[model samples]
Every structure is written in structure tokens, then in C-alpha cells.
Target: MKGKKILFILSGSIACFKACEVVSALIKNGAEVQTCATKNALNFIGEATLEGLTHKKVYHEMFESGSYLKHIELNSWAELTLLCPATANIINKIAAGIADDFASTLLAANDYKKPFLIAPAMNVNLYLNPATAESIEKLKKRGVVFIGPETGLLACGVKAIGKMSEPAEILKAVKEVL
Candidate 1:
């Protein structure tokens, strides 16, 4: 994966905290990483941590005056986009093509033919909700791939399939696609 540009989008989930490991793993494999955190995801993991790990700017907004139009540039820059610890809310938003935030905007701008991976993390009920299922189906039909919401203990003190998969597992999925 040398020189592959990986855009890691952290959504609003407690598991977003673990994305540091994913970033580290990707970098260790000689991949270039750029991270973007949703406003809600930042509540759990600070932007500094992501920026520090990526050694590049962490985008977290839709409208900002800067060197270039970030949303469009980032979509073109990334060779692959991975939504680690994708929350139910983010899934719904992306499936619906909502671009309210930087992450969602980048997602909407992505070419469907490009590699896109989503790893959803949410409670069992939310994971099984009709909207969630529908969103997943919609995204799947659009060619977005899923890593896992593995069956295991969750942050909410429940044992179900809504847990984020391990960083190694996520890395493997990324490798397979890229």
C-alpha cells in the first residue's frame, strides 16, 4: 500500500477513540493518511490527536476559507475512504446524501467507483432499526463496502454485533479493497 492515500473518517461513536490505532496501523504500512472527524466524533477524540497522527490537517467543517476548496480537493486526493466506527447517524446521513458536515460532504463528493469502506458501531437496536438497514442497503447498492460491527461486548454494556472491529481487522479489510 505504498503511497496510497487513505482518508479515515471518524464518526460519532465511543469507538471513534480507537481510530488512532487504525491510523497508526495504516501509517506503519507505508500508507499516507489524512483524518477527518465529525463534530460529534470530536467530543470523544480531539482534532489534535488526529492531526498529530496524520501529520496533515484534520478537516472538520464544510465551509472554511483556506488554501483551496477542501471538500472537493480531499475527495480527489483520497485513493480510498474508510469510515471507521461509523455511527448510525452518520450512516443515515451518508445514505441520504446529506452533506451537513465535512466528513459527510467529502463522502458525497466521492466517486462511487472509488473504494469506500464503512465500519458501523452502534447499539443492537439501532443497528437493527429499519432506517439503519435501509441505509446499509442503499449504500451497498451504491458499491460501498462494510467491514464489521462484530459480535462482542459493547460500550453500552451489552453483548451484541454492534461493536467496532479490531484495528487489525479493519486494516485487513482496507488492504483487500485497496
Candidate 2:
């Protein structure tokens, strides 16, 4: 999509580093990208790298200067919102309707009419949790799309189904949504 605007919302997960590759691939494929990292996500990837790649300011806080309504602005600017390496914590927050952080706020303010994709990455225990399962179903019913928590070795040193999908796979999913 030449003029499509894709907003990548990264959450705290070891897979956050892979998002850089995702951004690069998206830009190379002719999609405009805007990246915003959750507070915990910043712990893995720096804002400087995100800003440098997208050539757009990376938002992490609601009270950051230069915008009185960053969430609304970002929501309006995005054609599709994609949350890569979506953490179990962030997923729960979104499912519970929490909007305390910039990423969560944007997600909360997003219109369901637009495409919303989430790629979860967590331990197998968390992935298999009943709560997480229910939340996934609820989000699906609400029209949210999921990329993958592909089966593989996890950050916790366990072999299971909680790894983030490969960047190519995620990019393909994005294309399908767009």
C-alpha cells in the first residue's frame, strides 16, 4: 500500500528488538510507518532507534511535550494499528479497558472499524492461561486480529508456543489486513 499508514505499537517483550526489522521491512515495502513504544517496551528498544527508523517522533508518554492530544492524533493518523510482540501484561490491560499509558490510550481510543492486529509473546504458562485464552477470544469477537505466538523456544528458556512470529510472517499478516 503506497499511501497506507501503519502504526506499530510495541510492548515490553524480548521480541521488541525484532520490531526494528519489522519497521525496516514495512518501510521498504512502501508503507509509511509510525512507531510508539510502551513504557516497558522502551526497556528493550530505545526511542532513538525507533524515531530514526520511522523519521517520526516516537511517543511513550501521554504528557510528552509538543502535543496536547497525542493519542487522538496518532489514532487519526493510522490506517491500521499493529501491536508486535504484544506482552501478556499489555494484552490484559487492553482487555480490561485500561488506558494509563500512551500505547494503551491509543488502543482504547481506536475505532473498532479499523484493523487492529496483535502479536503476542509471552511464556507458555501465560499463553495457556485461561484468562489469556478468554481475552484472545473476546478481542477476536471485538474484531481484533492476531498474527502469532508461534511455537518455539521462549525467552524464559522454555520450549513452547509463546515466541513472536517471524518478521516476514508478521509483515504478511499486515499486508493481508491492509
lDDT of residue 106 for candidate 1? 83
Candidate 1, residues 80-154: lDDT per residue as tens digits? 999998999999999999987788888888887789999888999999999999999999999999988899999
**Model 2, range 98-177, lDDT digits (tens) per residue?**
99878988888888788999999999999888888888888998999998989998888888999999999999999988
73 in model 1: Cα distance from truth in Å?
0.5
> What C-alpha lDDT values do all the predictions have?
0.89, 0.89
Give me the runs in candidate 1 sitting further than 4 Å from their true place.
none
RMSD of 2: 0.9
* Candidate 1 residue pairs in clash (backbone atoms < 3 Å): none
lDDT of 2: 0.89
Which lDDT value does model 2 have at 172?
A: 94
Model 2: per-residue Cα lDDT at residue 96: 80
On the 0 to 100 scale, the lDDT of residue 55 in model 1 is 90
- TM-score per candidate, chains pooled: 0.96, 0.97
